[model samples]
Target: MTDRPDVLVVGAGPAGLTTALQACAHGASVRIVERRREPFRPSRAMIVHPRTLESLRPLGVVERLLRRGDPSPSARLHLGRRVVSTTLADVALRDTAFPHLTLLRQADVEQVLAEALEERGVPVERGVAAVGLAQDRAEATVTLRRDDGGAEPVSCGAVAGCDGQDSTVRRATGIDWRGRAYREEVVLADLDLDSDLDAGVLHVAAGRDGLVFLFALGEGAPWRLLATRPSRGGDAPFGQPGQPVPRPELRELLDVAGFDVAVGRVAWSARVRLQHRLAAAFRHGRVFLVGDAAHTHSPAAAQGMNTGILDAVNLGWKLPFAAHADEPDTMLDSYERERRPVARQVLALTHLVFFAEAAGHPAPAFLRGTVAPLLAPVVPSLTRPTLLAPVVRLLSQGWVRYRGSALSSERWAGGPGPRAGDRLPDETVTCDGMRTRLHRLTARPGVHVLLARDAEEVGASVVEDCPVSVHRLTSRPGRRMVAVRPDGHVGFRGTAVADLTAWLRLVGARARSADTATQPADTATQPADTATQAADTAET
Candidate 1:
């Protein structure tokens, strides 16, 4: 216990907790530290997209989250009483287990992750801040400062910077955080509403005055109200950063926007200036950046927390492989290559949406009174089910992939399906006597190989001392083998097992000769039957 843990995660938010949970699941000892003395109680990031839900299931917290959160099947856009547009239903998502967004408070998510970490014997160490960081070829050392002012250094095989925008770990690593802050400020408040708005749909309203977002926070929680307006000349009620909007001013803004809702109680409120930024690089030797530490942008589309969770999942599985000296550096290098592009895409998308919303200044009196009503009929077409699918897919992050990553090898050809660097599709298949899902079989710790036939016939072999699981699929087309990483992305796909064996060797998965006696003789072949049985019994 005194020795350095395999991974040290800074910031115990969703990103950090997810990294810890994934690391622990990968059989790596992990320690998570949070600067805050207690867990976050506010409902900061509230939407859990379907892709994120799919990614979290492997960490074992999705079911708990689904139980505590409300399913938002669709969203709606309103431009006052003149026009209202509803998004498409969940019909577009036939491959995913979760077809809708889950609305849960950020605090509840952290709680579920913390509980899971506890169950795995890894607890979040609160009130401990990483004051400094230093890394060498072998490990990274972090100096922690307790609330009482005592400072101590903890060494780890690697460090994950999941801290917020102002990250101490990032500063210690001296990575450049380049980005610009917006002139406008946003107001966020959780309010008890008296109106009869549907709790199952997100409502967004835009006017010449500004933009307003209404998100339901489950059954008992207060609804979240987010608004963005131009900053006033001097000290305004809500435009100033971190300022709390007075109840009277909040009600006035809503009334001006034509929303006849009574605000009973303000549970939480804050004004924040949006920014678009990304770290120059996500990795600095053994120290890597995840979540907000790597990128920050307007919360348009609620991509912040969800992207961070994906970052954790992407980097968590690679840490164990990179920790060993014998393993090739390609695994670690692929992390940045795969994730930085995603951050770039999310930042660009959110920035565009934020600015577009900002430009929707309050409608002119004439436009609101006459023009808007005349154009209301045409607005439905713009927001039709088919038209909204692309937006929904982007927001849900279902299309995100690592097609450009080094680990994505497509040397082997396959049928018309997901290729290397893409997420493994969720499918139901019967193996042995049980009917199970493909995701369930590969959702566990370590690398999973899905062979089209028997492992021995396909030449699928496990590397000595490498954590690999080979699962056989009797139904897949062709004689192809797909190796899925711990994070669920297809690492390699081909018809020949030699290519698979070469990739395992490249990632240092080959077994050592000295340990051959202790290893299973049919380690590669046995998984075929076991995976078939697992496929039958695996939970959907």
Candidate 2:
């Protein structure tokens, strides 16, 4: 395969593509082979979370996504005729620069990623299936079969599997997949619909027939309908592949949900069972796994693709460095440790939502009639934020951080009280007189700046004295500046430059003396200037 590409990636999906792109960005040569001879046919995961947006931004495609996708205003939960709870998209995510979720086809997101990857000079190779892998400490040899019955072996220092849940990579490595299979299956469809509903709203209703969820696809496309299983036992959770649900059958189902059909074409439909699973380990010798290759969970929170893409991003930058680095080789372990807990959290939360709906919660009808209207005003609070700091902290994507990571050390001074796994907060900021998201300011594949009130004293001499563009932040500036990692964790706090010297040693970057950093002589602050060589660590 072209004289042995540097990295052999099996699969061209979001996970694999992201891995390839990230690896390329780090200056590693890569070869990605896919069985599917074409791009995705339709939008699968239609919702892009803010964290995913952040990941895409560094690749220079976020604005394109925003321009092409529909901006969903909020997430609403309703009972038959009343609304039980409503989370305004804007308010719920006010903590994130991208406060709202964008509704777009998964294919759309892939297209953007694909273009960006090509522009970066690493295009994916399609129509070739990776059938086997053989890896040694020195290199990983990948076997590929072309559509024309040709075979080839490509060698690389490392191999990353970004394949889906039933990933061949997981099987090839022989890692035990551990998790429970959900009992319920869901029938989902994306299609055109005639509606008077607002384009930015996600409507969820409980009907006498079952539970129904409708999300506006865009201005004129089809709406995504997720209906609960009917009592007749005909509508199982996961639909069979050969037997298709006819238009009339789908119409009847909609009618039972109290929605009047306006006669539109169905774009896509499928039945999928909910699964919560994870690999026992994400790393094995020279082989590693990211995205769905490592974990799978229910889609209640719409976090699967988003989380997987992030997995690609997080592992992407690290792999190149680790592949070339020497010694302990402990850096890769952090991937599993940091991500496993996140998977568990996603599984739990998604299961919670599914359980609530399955139990009929406060009953769908009750929610639609009585709860929805009452909660609509608060919907903004529930939906919009710079990142889904609360829910995502578990998944470690959005504002999530890992203070106790391999890269972080507790010995650093003036460290915040946040723990190893906490989501960093977002602050409004103005750089160059152009007000922009704090997240937007952080250069890709690098650290973010969290300028604390004491940042001038503690950070000035360390980061400020360096060539890196560290945003100056205060606890209560017109906005806050929290230094986030490439993976979006708080790497350093600029609150107190008094701790500058200690932090520099921990970050492993060479820096000038701390003489440039001076807390006012009259300033009465504790001697946070503790002498320690540990790196600065923080919560997500």
Candidate 3:
């Protein structure tokens, strides 16, 4: 690295790549580093929810992923040979353009994001790992260690710890990683199966040990198998990493689970170690954690990479703005405010979801075998597409509300539509003389101000040292106005001009009376509302 960049991302996985891509998209100089010389091309995480796709749209990676990923797929739940199926289409949300669930390998996601970053002239330095970190009031310095015994110091305005479970950046912060690893090991393999099973359906069967999962979602392989290897000394000889997982051993587990599908070829196989962990603090001084560096959970809910990507999204928009603020520390604290709680909630949510599938083989022998057969007919209904709608919605994360956040302010806060701290769903609108979705207006970086056609007269007064894009609503009629944050959440919503200005000012937004903005807004004629506005918003 030469001159200091705005951000230094220390991992090239989904989280690190997304952090670099998004920070670059928002006009920040970002340098990303990866310890591994060769990319982890394995199909580790094979699921991408719709909300994650919506969040990545601004970075121009979602469409590429959709082109190469499977959009609609059915899942088959096998309980003692009685199979019940469900399709993602049945649980699709009508409001979002990307409603259906998508299946894409984690490797593909990293590739698309890395390519996008390369297009923006941000190169990912491979074979370079951040071994040491030190930060003061000015900037953060990181020690980079290469594979060939080369070491150098790289400086950056801030360091994003996209590094995984063993994060050196996290260690530098002295934040305790509070988590535990599962006793049972998981064997991950991409297998070619010889069976009549639908190629587009995901298969999972309950066994005396744990759930046996077979996925047919990858672009190349037709099936990827995830099965639990009972604690050491079990009949299944799926040993520790680097130990060979024989095809007969895999067959032995499948036979006990009643899956008669023949394993044709073991294209790729690895013994996976499962762990659950979350960082004590997501931010420490100039060092911030993202992805597995911040939190790691079981892949049962497909939340591992998606949650990391969400972590990156929440931190990406704020890191770029921190480079310009006078009070960078105070400016960055809100990132934890808005996101830390969400991570905590996810940690708890995924913990339960992970065990719901009996992962790690924790269930008793009777429940795994005898009880499953007895309840086969009734238990399968739990996976019915209609009933899974709420589960799907929860997994989509579109319903996540940040109403308690300081960035969210409500005036008498009662309304039928979205309030401050709520997600801003896409709506039809025209831009540049062409009809487009509302979310498209944010293809560029900065805060987006959505104003009713009638409110244009008052919208100009809303200015910020930070780049702000203001759009006048012409497709509909109303006096309501809303401010959409860079992370796609509503910061403020109201109809009064004075109230909106007060919010802008509260959020460190500058007021304009002349060619340039005045720091202390001339509030001589401005009338402030008691409830419509309160607290601060994003800083420049």
As a whole number from 0 to 100, the lDDT of residue 63 in candidate 1 is 64
- lDDT per residue for candidate 3 within 1-540, as digits (tens), equals 347888999999999999888787766788899998987557678889977976776566666787778777777878786877667754636545565778788888988888888887887889998888898978899999999989988888889998887788899899998988766667777778888888778888887677788877543466778887554433332122334478888888778778878988787676766677878898888889998888877676788899889878878877776655544565588777777788787888877866655554446555766687777677556766667667877987777877877667575256556799888887666433445556555544556666766664444443233555566666656777787776778878887767766665444443333222211111210122111111010000
Give lDDT per model, in order. Answer: 0.73, 0.59, 0.71
For 1-540, candidate 2 gives per-residue lDDT tens digits of 246666778877778888887777655677777787887554446677767765655555666677677664565555444454434345354545565556777777777778877886777788888788888877788787898999987788778888677777789889998887666556667667776755567777655334677877632345777765522333333212223456776677676666655648776675665567878888887788887778877666677788888778777756655543333265567677677777667767777776655434447546544555566666556543433446543332554557667655333345544432345444454443433444444534444444544435223333321222344443334222243445555555433443433444444322323242222211111112111001001101
Give candidate 2 misplaced runs (Cα > 4 Å).
72-78, 83-89, 92-95, 191-201, 208-210, 216-221, 230-243, 262-264, 324-328, 359-399, 413-424, 428-437, 448-484, 492-540
Give RMSD to native, each candidate. Answer: 5.3, 8.8, 8.1
Candidate 1: minimum summed lDDT over ten consecutive residues — where? 513-522
lDDT of 3 at 505: 47
Of the pair 1 and 3, which is ahead by TM-score?
1
Of the two candidates 1 and 2, the one with more favorable lDDT, higher being better, is 1
Backbone clash pairs in model 3 (N, Cα, C under 3 Å; residues 3+ apart or in different chains), count = 1
Deviation in Å, model 1, residue 531 alpha carbon? 21
lDDT of 1 by residue, 1-540 (tens): 335898999999899999998877766788898988978556557778878877876666766786777664466666657646555444356566665566777788889999989887887889999988888888889999999999989999889999888888888889998987766677778789999878778777666666777877632346888787765334432112476778887887688677778889887676766667899999999899999999988777889899999999998877876544244488888889999988999998888777666644334434543465567678777765456566667897778788878788887554676788899988875433344567656555567777664443434345433467666565654577777877878888887767877776665553222232222212322223342233224335
Clash pairs detected, candidate 3: 507-537
Model 2 — TM-score against the truth?
A: 0.76
